[model samples]
Target: MTPSLLEALHWSTMDISGAEYRGKEVPLLVVPTRYLLKLDTTMISYCDMQRVLFEEEKSAYNQAMQQNICDGKIHPLTSIHHTSTYNSLCKLMEYCLSPAVTTLQDRLKENELRLSMLQEEAKQLEADTQNMRNGSPRRLMNHGAGGKSSPTAQSRHPFSNQGSPRSPSGGSRRRAC
Candidate 1:
């Protein structure tokens, strides 16, 4: 109160009159989280999906084996074969799940570059407007002509007859108020 930079009281300041904190017991509600999660109970799990894909792959291989009676046919149940199948499945899953993050990042970069370019243009236009609002160097130089101003662009400059009378009625100031 006396300009001493005193610290303000916080919630834990129990020494003040009737200032103790009170606890409340509120009933908790079980809010539905369905909106928070993008989950469907009907969707199969990843392991189930992989099992189904493996069954399909095996059926396709069996059909191919029936069609081709070559004795040098490679076995389908090898560990290397399973690895390649899993790798292909994972690649498919990744391709399906990817959200085009790189494309969005590229677009964001382009927009930022455009924004900076527009800001620079705005700055240049602001400077030009300021220069035009005040008297420009060209206008100032043209005002050095004698009292007889030509009826051209130079004579129409804002500072053309600045040193002459400023009023229509007969005030003697150099500039209009």
Candidate 2:
């Protein structure tokens, strides 16, 4: 039944060999509508082809369907296409994300370093203030007379003291004989 149906196919204008050449006539293989419906009841077949075959002639559905029908085989191409697409998408994602990851790591390290430096500066300022309150400076310069500093030398006002002790009244405290 299948061989007879397939063998009966013929061109309405020309045939399958001349399908590439296009002018006015649509290249179509003419077959009985009953044979095509019985042989190609399912969606994907020679009958379902857009312009390859013509299956809309005389309707003889019930008589043609009574015979044994053999269907065409199909192969899917999605697996090949999807594998390549997955690889490309993965590469694109890595390319887009690399710079942000590097920048985030660098900024975190910089933040830690800056915080430690600020803590060390605070400790130094605390020590300097303690020294000022204790009536001493952080360092003392040596004079020609001696490198040894008197205990009371830095006890006066840091800006006003001239190495002499003066009474609070701004004069000598001794009485005249």
Best by TM-score: 2
RMSD of 1: 22.8
- Among these predictions, the greatest lDDT belongs to 1
For candidate 1, the per-residue lDDT at 150 reads 37
For 21-91, candidate 1 gives per-residue lDDT tens digits of 89999998876787655433323354466567767776765565565545766455554565576568667
Residue 27, model 2: lDDT of 88
lDDT of 2 by residue, 1-177 (tens): 687665666443447667797579778899988766752244234224422322221122222333323353222344344446555655665565566557657877998999997786667557546656765442422221142433334433353234334444578663343
Model 2 global lDDT (CA atoms, 0 to 1): 0.48
